[model samples]
Target: MAFIFESDLKAFLFCLLQFVIAIVVSYSFSNYTNPEQRKLEKVAMLELKVEQTEKDIEQLRDLTRSLEGKYQNIESVHVPLVAFHVYNPLHTNLEVGQVIVYQTVPLNEGNGYDRKTGIFTTPVTGLYQFSAHICNQDNAMFVYAIVLEGETIALSTQRDMPSSCNTVNALTVASAGQQVSVQGVHMSKSYQVIENPHRKNSFNGVLLHRT
Candidate 1:
């Protein structure tokens, strides 16, 4: 009886060991032989990533195309607004009320602002480039380049020391009309007409340019 019980116990232990071994072997074999499953999963992940990349590339292409169209449109128009005023020799001492026309005027009264001498208001919307020169008047004479958009100062320069009489100083403005002016004491004693008398005072309007 003792021998039979011992034999039974031995058989049971052996069976349990075999079952554990079989389970381990089956699990290992399943992982090894089915590498294709893992490969398929990797391929699916790669395909998904590639699809996302393609979508991103498409979006970038669209942005580039849109920018190109705008760039072309900008390239077409290229007009610049140019403005120049002649220095006045008689401007030895410009008084408070002394007024001068810097550009040509139509039948209408030109819109010129006298915040200071050598300055004018823009009557129309357009690019307004400004320039000026002074002569005879030494360091004592000065030309102030005060360019304004509405009441905003876009550019300002004071030519306290100028070399030539016909020297040129300038500024540019946008829109049909705006206000621009210079600040300086002119040689009120004497003045000369600019070569282009039409654009002498505040008569000439600047041309609009596409940037």
Candidate 2:
């Protein structure tokens, strides 16, 4: 009876040792695998954040390029221009309603004024200021008109005198291709005269504002 009890105690201890070994191995494996799984999850989240940041940076670059292109286009199209000044020192004869053509050009920026035809053509739509100085050396009367598109807008008249000077100026809006000129009106004498270089009979036009 004593021998049987001793053997049963030995067998019980052996089974208890096996159960403790299984519990220790299970706890060690759980501890090691849990940390590795958490690390993998964190790595995945960081990679996703990095991808989102890259996409945001690309979008910003595209917007900047678009704005730069628009600025370049604006710079190419919007340019300011148009100015001219002409003079005539030689003597000229004109009949009724004849244009007083200038033969000398001091400054013609946009080439809007024609010396031979005595006319100015606008290059752009804008407000323009025009002026004319008429000098008569002869004793006869001299009269001139500033004409825009064949209509007299301003007039300058000088009576019979040894030396006479008359000036006329006008401010008006003009479109592209519109014509402006100075015309002579018939007085008691048939000739309209321009004196020497000192008299400086001149005509000038300038652009004030662009529409």
lDDT string, candidate 1, 1-211, tens digits? 9999999999999999999999999999998978988899999999999999999999999999999999988765645334333332223344533443333223223434332343555555555555444333334433333345434332222233432344344546445444554434333223322233322333233444544
Top lDDT hit? 2
**lDDT values, one for every candidate:** 0.49, 0.84
- Superposed Cα deviation of residue 88, candidate 2 (Å): 1.2
TM-score of each: 0.35, 0.68
lDDT of 2 by residue, 1-211 (tens): 9999999999999999999999999999999999999999999999999999999999999999999999988865564778999887334677778887888898998899988788999988889999999887578777888889988888977875677778899999899899998888756565667567577788899998777
- C-alpha displacement of 165 in model 1, angstroms? 24
Worst ten in a row by lDDT for model 1: 192-201
